[model samples]
Target chain A: MKSNEVRVARFDGYERVMHWMAALSFLYAALTGLAIWSPVLYWMAALSGGGFVIRGTHPWSGVLFTAVIGWMFARWAKTMGLDADDRVWLTRMDKYATHQHDALPESGKFNAGQKMLFWSQVVTALLLMVSGVVLWFPEWMPRSLRLVAIAMHPLAAIGSIAGIIVHIYMGTMSVPRSMRAMLLGWVTPNWARLHHPKWYREWRGSTNLR
Target chain B: MLVAKLIDTTLCIGCKACEVACQEWNDQEYTLGTFNGSYQTMPDLAPNFWNLIKFNEVQRNGAEAWLMSKYQCMHCADAGCLAACPAPGAITQLANGTVDFVHENCIGCGYCITGCPFDVPKLSPASKKVYKCSLCSDRTAVGLEPACIKTCPTNCLTFGERDEMIRVAEIRTRELKADGFKDAGIYNPAGVGGTNVIYVLNDAKQPEQYGLPKDPIIPWTVQLWKGPLKALGAMVFMGSILGAFFHYVVFGPQQEEAADEVE
Candidate 1:
């Protein structure tokens, strides 16, 4: 039971849809990508009709994922900007890892962990896109260039996947009530207060009618 | 059983019939690129195109050289992408040692992109799906050769049982070594749990000479960061769910007044 007095819409309906779309698309890319890469999960191709289907679907879904993530970046990049508090919070990540909620520093709309996830996504997305393009056009370029692209693409994908695992954990499991913002586009006052007191206060102080 | 490929680069004529056949058999469209280049039209593997032939010009032994090889999924045994996938239906292993993909169960996290050692998978923009080469599973289901194998004018690519392929690769490597290729050897038999697609290089050159990794391993960070965190997160999720269920069952629903008071 929580108070309903301090309610606010943290995300718009479109934003929530985009967030989920990005999430879903990214998931598709990751799974099929793995199926193509290794025999250990070659069975995954059955999900897409077979290995060929996974192959056909992986890149197109990646493009869609990148597009949606790009939209999410535009919508949230400003709020996700790092600040002094974020630095302090990042330096004290061990507290969060140990589940020391009381010692956890207060944050804004996005915490230090969330900000790191955002920026990692941004950098990895750029790297995957660039490397993917080179891979896509190997015949058009010199072999040396194609080899470089091949090497860089996998490395970038690996880093991005690792970042995403952390992002998913923080968003869905570790932080209570955080997923509700993305799910319902709103947050209860108490939840906002507990997790993002600064953002809660800012929203309370705002003169906007909504 | 460890599967391998013995790709004889010398046998490759750079005709690209293999690429065309793969596209045709897979019902993929021709990926046309800039017009001014040689017959190297289909640029690379996309969500649509699963296979491609790469052309390389190098200064080998201080002499100008041209090299060509067909490229597709390597099908590593300890696939990074498989280990990284979060969804259950995303990736699976087949009976014949081929890795497969499932689309209906996919949630599109893109974890596989990072897990792959070869970076083979590509994302499509229009349909929001992921795609890669599956080694012609459809054709194999009917006991037919892969389209690329059937259409290769030079017989550069071959498909067969995993064990038989490895045996042939070894014999070919030995023969190539006797034929003046002192460095000829099979690639990726034990590298990543053994690749199903084997390569027979043109000469006794390192795999790096033809743009393949000498040693590919799942990145340590995956084990370090994702492996443990995913397990811990699942535990938390289950614990939270069970805790909420227990609280509701034991304490019963809260009265409106009590709920209001807590708030």
Candidate 2:
């Protein structure tokens, strides 16, 4: 093998762009939303321009975030689906968390924990969008529906936010060097094989890059 | 004295002089509309019409009754609009208990409309801001009564300090009760810490009939859930960091894959 050939195509450029768009917008929406949600954090409102800007931008960015999530769901839903092995991986989430890879189930492109995060976020994002529209122009909505929407918006937001925290941490921190795939749309061949051996084997047998 | 208004629904002649006075004083025109076979004009509050008279007819024991109410903001001690507003200074609860708006500070996010139990504020697409009766803050600030109060021929709408207004409303309520109106009562909802603008309703037992909420509390979830959710966000953020640290300390990061076939 050539020493220069150190990379594997883990994500295409378009996929990486969609991923960054989702990540960046989700962060903005979460931050601006937090600023609007709590008076103590109102000072953070300046990050989105101002208090009014937070109110206005938060919902719109939420819409953008949902769209990106929708695109992500379309792209990855098949790969992220749960099977018997996924259930096993979830049952042994403790092993994965502690990097007991030998004890961990043979993961595909995404592990069970990642699948769980994806599905939870998808549900939460859809709920947020539906509830956000109710809150967006509540002047026209009946009082009862608006009240429910107002209450549920936060609940869904809380779930998605916490899930996202774990997701970002897992993607970038828990498994070190994992962000190379997301950042530059490639991972070291070694990184791919270690994290996703099944994918590596499939790719190795199908194509010879060099 | 801090300003307040008394809206005696029993005394309201449904003259709509106050409505006209409101439009005149504010220098505004109302939305175009055709009569919907009801005396109730424009259906509900709008940007143009800050004040409105709601009409209701009921058949009570072989007699037809036409009930009228001067519907507007209650200007509560704990205003829902102020609580739900995300934009700073967009909605203000004055020292006098008059809830007003600083339009320049308002961003057209309709949370206030949902927050308001009375359904007072309306979004004006033209101005792209919520507008409602500011309790004539401009006139009251100058020591003049609101245009609505000034033009009320029956002397129904009165303005004064908050305590005095409540006192007057209580007395009126007693007189109506003695007059054999069994349900006559004051409509200063206690749930919102009582409103500056009290109402002497001939039949307060059914505020819903007059399009007023029987219990006008500020939307509780908006206020209640915020603190817990904020705490949750902080905890989750910390948990992510801690979880990662613990995983790394234990596993020391996955080694570069030694499988050289792919590499």
Candidate 3:
């Protein structure tokens, strides 16, 4: 955070804004959904509006999140794809978890774990949207389909919520400069070189061209 | 005393007086009945129209027989609507076996509709709240019979203690069997742990002919979703948080090593 530190561009301003939109909407929808999922968590409804209001607005929030996710997929799908290096990184995940980062493959813009998070989020979001629509308009669907949706919606929600919890924990606690990159769209060259050597090298090459 | 209503289908004349009384007492809007080629009025129960008389014409021994029966919430002892409802106290089973809907607490999610084995709960399009028969808890709490029972002129609908009502229904079933209804029996389906509304059917072998399910049970999907599925989801949610916390405590934050930084 020194003023004289050499900084490298990570996320752009538009990407940061889009990420916040996705995060906020996802949190709202997940909270409201949890409120309506069980009476034990019914108290969560009081935190937002009431039970009826949460029930009504939860699906709309889900729609907003799905829209943001679509934007993210279009923007980052190319970089987020898994490759040979990512597979190598995945195999060395135990080392990564144990802070043996030197043993893992060089990371690019996103690490293997981040790519996995992105893909899992995409899958769970798709499940939520389809099942959410079915639940919202139950009268339009057959009982069998509705039954499947009622079950699928919660399962997908559980998956996404748990994944996001880990994402949040990693972003804010486990890694230091990750949140700053998402917030200010910049990270120090040393930080990037330490965490994502391939990305730092690519940025250095692009800057040298200019 | 667990109060109940015993409906003797043999004594019913398909007059629908109980339905009329129910509408009048509940102050529901007057709905025009279409000619569905039957004496029965509406196709099914509506949010406002809680009680109904279903008329089913069946061929028995090559003779046309009309099976007329009053239909409403069964008020099961193990009420599925109450079980599946996420909104606390929105749907509750009273001490007298009446399943009541507190519309104020209703989130209008329609989970009750899916949970109900009888498909009794209907979501009101206007209010967005689910509604069903209250078994006239208001009147019964004040020592008065339900409007439907009081208005039934043929003594077909009778209200009393649950045990006494079952006894009365058993007697009626015996009398019906003696009078050539060989399959006459009482219907208080045990699948839902019996119901406050018991019926003495002339042809109990085919309750479906009376517009009643032979083996009505809470949908297994709802049971699984609200029961073990909910428990599993909670466990996973907590497990993830605790796992993250324990990881943070054990390995600490993965900070950058000073030697790795090339300033």
Quality of candidate 2 docking, DockQ = 0.54
Scored by lDDT, the top model is 3
Mind giving the per-residue lDDT tens digits that candidate 1 earns over A51-78? 5466557778888888888898888899
Model 1 TM-score on a 0 to 1 scale: 0.54
2 versus 3: better TM-score goes to: 3
Between candidates 2 and 3, the one scoring higher on DockQ is 2
Q: What's model 1's overall lDDT?
A: 0.69
Summarize candidate 3's per-residue lDDT along A168-208 as a digit string, tens digits.
Answer: 99999899768989999998777787788899888877774
Off by over 4 Å in 2: A2-6, A53-56, A208-210, B1-3, B225-227, B241-252, B259-263
Worst 10 residues of 3 chain B by lDDT: B254-263
Please give the clash total of every predicted structure, in order.
67, 0, 0
lDDT of 3 by residue, B155-249 (tens): 99999999999999888888888899899999999999999999999888999999999998877777877888898898999999999999999
lDDT value, residue B176 of candidate 2 = 96
| Candidate number with the higher DockQ (1 or 3) | 3
**Candidate 2 residue lDDT tens string, A1-210:** 642266778889889999899889999988887777766777888876887566667888999999999999999999998888879888888787666788976777777887898899899999999998888877667778888887788788888887887777677666777887788877766676788877777777777665
lDDT of 2 at A97: 64
Give candidate 3's error at residue A78 in angstroms.
2.5
Candidate 3 chain A least-lDDT 10 residues? A1-10
lDDT of 2: 0.82
